[model samples]
Target: MQLASNKGLTARNDNPLFWSLRNAFVRGDTNGLDRELRYSFQSFLLRNKFSKSVTASHKKLADLRYPYDWFPATRAMQRTIHLHVGPTNSGKTYHALKALENAETGIYAGPLRLLAHEVFARFTAKGKPCALITGEEQRIPEGTDRYFASCTVEMAPLNKRVDVAVIDEIQMIADQERGWAWTQAVLGLQARELHLCGEERAVDIIKAMCARMGDKCIVHTYKRLNPLRTMQESLQGDFRKLEKGDCVVSFTRIGLHTLKAGIEKITGRRCAVVYGSLPPETRAQQAALFNDPNNDYDFIVASDAIGMGLNLEIKRVIFEAVTKYDGGGHRVLTVPEVRQIGGRAGRYRTAAQDIKDNHTDTTSRPTSKNAPAGMPASAGLVTTLDDEDLGVVQAAFTSEAEPIKAAGILPPTFIIEQFYSYFSEDTPLSFVLARMREMAKLSEEFQMCSIVPLMEVADLIQEFPMSIQDRLIFLTAPANFHGTGQKQVLKVLARCISENRTAHLLDIEGLDLDILDIERGAADVNNTQYLQRLEELHKSITLYLWLSYRYQGVLTSQHLAFHVKSLVEEKIKDFLDNLSFTVEGRKAKRQQTRLLVERHRKLEEKILGDEPSNEAELVQEGPGAWSEEGHEEALMEDEAEAEDPVGLPDAIREVVSDDRLPRPAGEDVRT
Candidate 1:
């Protein structure tokens, strides 16, 4: 109490008003001392007011219990929601898309860029003014001020008002990693009429959302246009018996290639392949090859990538195995996965062609929004490659998936920016993100989106000095941080941004030119190391282009990155075309078919052994982060295969667990 000589007290006492009061005290002047004391009291009141204002701001940013109120513009408008609920091949998307086509101004938001491209192409072919927008790519028609938009879900324009909107694969609202995008589109899109197309499982959840918003919800249920039957007998592990219109579905890149090579070797017919990691353009090219009847590619060797919006003309669906490695661990496929993949078979082209023929003039065509619904396709057949998988596939087809309970959500950028202001400038970003997620007060209808990947990304770029806003932008960029050449490129880009310099892919340090070159050999096609490098390079270039769009002048190598990406895709296609499974010996052509089938069976046994049958343990699951132990185990298996010709058991134990393979340019990669 007697420490007026202390540094803090001495500094305060040195103020002019304090000096006046002290001088008055020393001279015994009571009037001057009272005036100085009044001045001090007024200063205290003003400082307290400013402190209260800051406390109020903090409270406002902390109140996140009502996320629906964030989008005030959307809430003020009267909206009508249409739910197109049906199984695959039931024309749900077709009808919803038709409504979008008829509207004066509308948007089509799909789960994949491939689907967005397809819709954009269709609208352009019909001579409609349309624009395509994805994370990495944007195409705007010349001289068109008013036009339709086709975009991926995450790229949907929330600020623009439209007459109609269509959101495909609405059931994805429950996805753990990316579901927030779907939920955001549904809630924030300023549309007079919004059409949501997907399975019936999403109906109740969406209706609940609409009820909260006071929007009218109307659900249209549809039955499969064609019959589908599960076969009792499997292929009995015989690749020789695969027919012309068969699609053999497997869960791994190696497994699909093995099937493709073995079938081509034995049957003397070419096979096309599709998976998640392959570029969407590459997947489309393969599908086109298989769909053309005159082509030598009479069969498809694919992963679950065919499940969503990819229309293939196949007579039968053959399962290589019912079990899949879902990043975290080995798990059985869920009911939705089995149904969606199995439903790609038996497309009815002639019926759709008949309708197209009747409507020769696009201007005079009847809109599907109000027209009566028509029949869709023909009967689709489903079976298994081995007897062990048949029972599991059949059971999955008969079962139903659990209904969704809540939509995923994350704080908007502005909300995050305000929250960041509460922390010191030097606080670690990972810590800030974790604290925000923990402190968030979520409503019962919404759950916090996974921030693990964001946190991981924050840790990777913590060494770089940047503003909080700039740091967030880098944190959200869809770039790989895994131990690969791509990770090196990502670090370089971060360094450039931190230093406020331009980034160019070609100018990056230790850049490998060989990644763009194709390795010419049959063995190289099956070489895991070679294929992984190719995929990594392709994804890295794509990530560069994605950032260039956002950063514009800062990342100035967009043109070169685009050129390299196309070249890489072509190399990938060439590699897939020449891929084949080879054995130790080969005899005459007639005997080759028989001998190859036998060897293929032996090869499979050596890799996967017999399938397991623990029915009770097959829990319904979603994609999750790959466990470190599982990834280490897979690396060890890869090493074993390189050391010995006989492959390690469970070599394909940990496939990329995403429903689709690694995402393309605009999409986030699984950790």
Candidate 2:
């Protein structure tokens, strides 16, 4: 029987039935494995003509254990994958977009409404069906496979299935108030695959958390596209000497305006302006004017807002100040902020390409005679924020609850996760909970009369959740302390917030030491003035803190009552102070003060009234010379006119401009 079995096994190995069985095993077909194995044995007996020896071999095969019985074959299947880590320029969004191009359905989630519009246009250009969903606008397409848009992540519906979801600027997950929204989006997104993009530090934390949650996380790091071209020497003398295409980056609105005026005065060339206060449409228009290839504008005077979104064709970036008021005090720019603004210079591809060609042909070409001063080495300068004592004061005004989650908007799980992200082992969850309890007690004791409604306040606190409320409390509590050395600091904050007044209250020379003392807790205090200042500062701080916690819904007049009172007190005090003189002096002061008082009263009334003022006034007047007749003709002189196609190097300038370039066959022209 043994000899017969060996012969049968050898014969079966060469049979077609046995070959089919083996193929089934290799392909990981479980049902096919069992069926084919049985068939192979039976077929072998029949093919060998069923002799006594073959029959005996079949009997022995039946007695022997089959490989299928020991191990079952299983197929490998594709699983949805998510990537959630990267810095600003790391191409995290780029990678996700690439995937979206191939996916049956995909969505690109952006943080801002403007960003959503930009992405929607980008995806639409790519010949993909896209939609925009922002708080201001929602445009959903019927039966669309992909969504290129922006929405408050917390408010976005999760029921819709997507093949892949890309969440841009995921670091917003740590935002004090709105962090909950991002956190919810990260946790609740139902896409088969998820992708997150943002700064490296924030991404690292997110990636770690995702790993802990059993989701696959991948990280991509990218250096800034344009690094600062550090100068061997600093720029000296007047800023008017700054060549065309230079960007003058100032910290303050006044500084930006002054720099623009100074540049125009010296160069006799009009400068374009871009800053935060300007509308998005205006900012875009200004950026375009500065970046125009026709070179219409000579210089751009801008604030830090220029550091984001719109691309400017800048050759050099000049810093008017290195530090900015961050709503608390003067603080130095963070590494990321500095890098962002500096990166704007030398980013103009057309300009950079030309510069590179000029450098390469310096020895061999005549064009090297005038290459525009080598484009100012693509460098930037840094300046210090003048008064450091005001940094904390500035922070106090701006320090409000970040609106991590809009009330009634985010999921419970997301709110919980957001709270968890803030605590390390050092700070216990119980401490945070305790703070929330204290806040609750305060709210109950100082509850506004029911005439206005208590439900609104309760709803506001409920909307923020305990974690967010406690965080705001902690952030603003430091400014509420009293002491002799802290008198000036407390008074400055109180005056600034209560009156909406920003003046040079502290000496610039002593600012650094004062700031250090406050931060170090080394300042001493025991005066009534200091205590009174602290009390006033505390009220302002508390108002901001409460507003931050309850700012999700439509704002009510009661909510703004304290702010109005503060403004009124500030105006009244100014009026009284200005009238402390002779009768004639007092009368003149009174007239001026009365006009201001009336304006303030009108503003207050407008705030309370259904109709708010929407007045538009010219921010800056053109020069008297420009206002005269032939100004346009004079300004048009020395203009490059039209770009000389032949003047541009062959390698740098294509026969057709990028806009007119012919598309490759089979490539999507929409994109």
Candidate 3:
């Protein structure tokens, strides 16, 4: 009672509940004390209502409903938006890029690094001063000050003003995992003319956004140059009937290699394989081999990586299955996926080819828009390997995809930092992220992106004594914890950061030149541990490169990391070239699933205790506590979704632009 009085605790409206309760207690009035306690409880509840309890800072951080307002410069501009809406192989991107090519100053933001690389190559070949920027690398041409910039969407410059900007694959605004990048680009890019190229499905949503911005919107509809037709009959799982120009699509890396082997065995022609896990350069090489008419490579075995506008000289698309395992479980392919992948079958005159031909034609030879000069256009054909998948493919092509309703957004680092300031210094980063998610305020037009991956990273680096800003940097790194060697590499880097020591390429354990040396190739690619190690090593090097750009001095071996990355990629390519694996239907899947379950069981056992397990502590205490060796089976089956490629945050952007080292929080903002 005395303590309560000192703290100015009292009842409302002269009720004197605290005093009454004290009086009751002193007089031994049990009923009065109970009544006073109930009244006091009600008073406390009324006083500490949700609205009253929430601080102004908490409300400010949670109110992410108006993302447009975040970019004041972009919002101030009255921009012109050109919506180039069409299906694949429709030359939609061609017209948009043409405008960009002619512009004095421009930027082309694409979804994939491959696309950015392609644009950079095209512009460089044309002798245009262009710069390429992606999460992994940046290549700036000599004697240029941003005349043209080709970058992954996340890396698009929001602060710099450009005359024209092209945001390719605008339909990705609805993508669950990476939609926020597209959204950020669309909402934040400072451009006089913005070209948005994508499917017709994104038209309304984009128009709605433009209307909200009070910008003039122009829609340009495009038709495919080559007609696409769904075949009436399936291949009936017959590899012998597969044609030379056919592209067989499968979901898994193992499945891709198995299909390649099976197709080669029956057809007696070399098959080039492409999948997501493979490096982009390797995939491009495989595509080039399949495209070259003089080469013995005829058929191409690929994953959905081809769906992302990978221009291959494919005559027909044969779907091995209409479903894929998306982290959680098997789900039917969406209309957009089916359309995008199937659309790659026969690109009569791709944007790149068109640009090349036009540039080389010194005699000014005129060519038809639909087909190149003296070349007959081929129609794209779609079919299924098995009889049951045909209907699914047909239905997906004919049906319309649902219109995108909302754009994905993440709580910016500054907002996160503001929220973190309210918590104790000892509070776990994961706890702060969880609380933010719980208290998030979103409107119907916007949705918060999944921060589960961030939470996982936070948990991994929880024991490290690092600043909030440094921790955010790691959390945003392109490290999927479940990836084969990613967790191991991340742990090493985190320890170095915590200890304020520079991390060298040699500091990483179990990764050496001997490990990456693939003299020949694996006999069995499907279940081989060596091939898995190479892939893991490739990812590890890529992660290092990504970190190198952000923590320049801290991760000091960018040159060595790039060299090792190339070596790993070459080894992987060699492995693919010599692989001759035979797999029955879904045999590899079962094997991998079992292995993943067992490994996960073991991980659970290690972490299951009175308190949460410190992953960093485990790494320091145990040699291979988190090392994912011989778990190629788990690597093959239970790969987590790719982490969101974080772009240059406002603070990081300033440091990068200035070409200086990171400064203190007072001097420079948090990343």
Stretches off by above 4 angstroms in model 3 are: 1-56, 274-289, 292-296, 359-377, 509-514, 517-528, 583-635, 638-671
- Candidate with the greatest lDDT versus the true structure: 3
How many steric clashes does model 2 contain?
Answer: 25
Model 1 weakest 10-residue run by lDDT: 628-637
- Shift in Å, residue 211, candidate 1: 0.7
Q: Residue by residue across 1-671, what tens digits does model 2's lDDT show?
A: 24223543312223424334433332222433554455445434434444676445434332211211111110011224454343223334555656666677766665444445555655665667777764323567678544544443433555566777777666545532245455556655666677766655465446544543456666666554333443433344345457677787765443455456656666788789766434345655776677664755888887654444334566666654444433212234545555455545654232223323532221121111112454333333322222321332233223332211111112233333344354453443333332221112111001111110111122223322244444333232222221233334334333333343432322211112222122111246322222233334433333333333333231133334344434433432232222211223212222332233334334334433443212211111111011111111011100111110113233223322233424465432111
Clashes in candidate 3: how many? 0
Cα RMSDs of all predictions?
16.9, 30.0, 15.9
TM-score for each prediction?
0.75, 0.43, 0.76
Stronger candidate by lDDT (1 vs 3): 3
Tens-place lDDT per residue, model 3, 419-478, is 888767887787677566555666666666555567778878888899999999987777
| TM-score of decoy 3 | 0.76
- Model 1: lDDT of residue 4: 32
**Model 2 superposed RMSD (Cα):** 30.0
After superposing candidate 1 on the true structure, give the runs of residues whose Cα lies further than 4 Å from its correct spot: 1-63, 252-254, 274-285, 292-296, 350-377, 517-526, 582-646, 649-671
Model 1, span 1-671: residue lDDT tens: 23432432322213334433553332222333453455445444533443566756655775677877889999999999999998887778777877887899999998766677778877876778999998778898899788999997888999999999999888878775567888899999999999999989889989999998989999999887667779889988777877777898866555566567788888889999866456656766887787777778888987666676667777789987665544332345778888888887765442233234634322232212111124223557899877766887899788898777768778888898887787677666776565565346666667666565676677678888888788788766766444467667777888888897998777886455576654755455445565556656766776688788878778898999888878876766565555555432111111222232334344334533565421111122232222211011121112222222333123122223213333355432211
Evaluated at residue 59, the lDDT of candidate 1 is 55
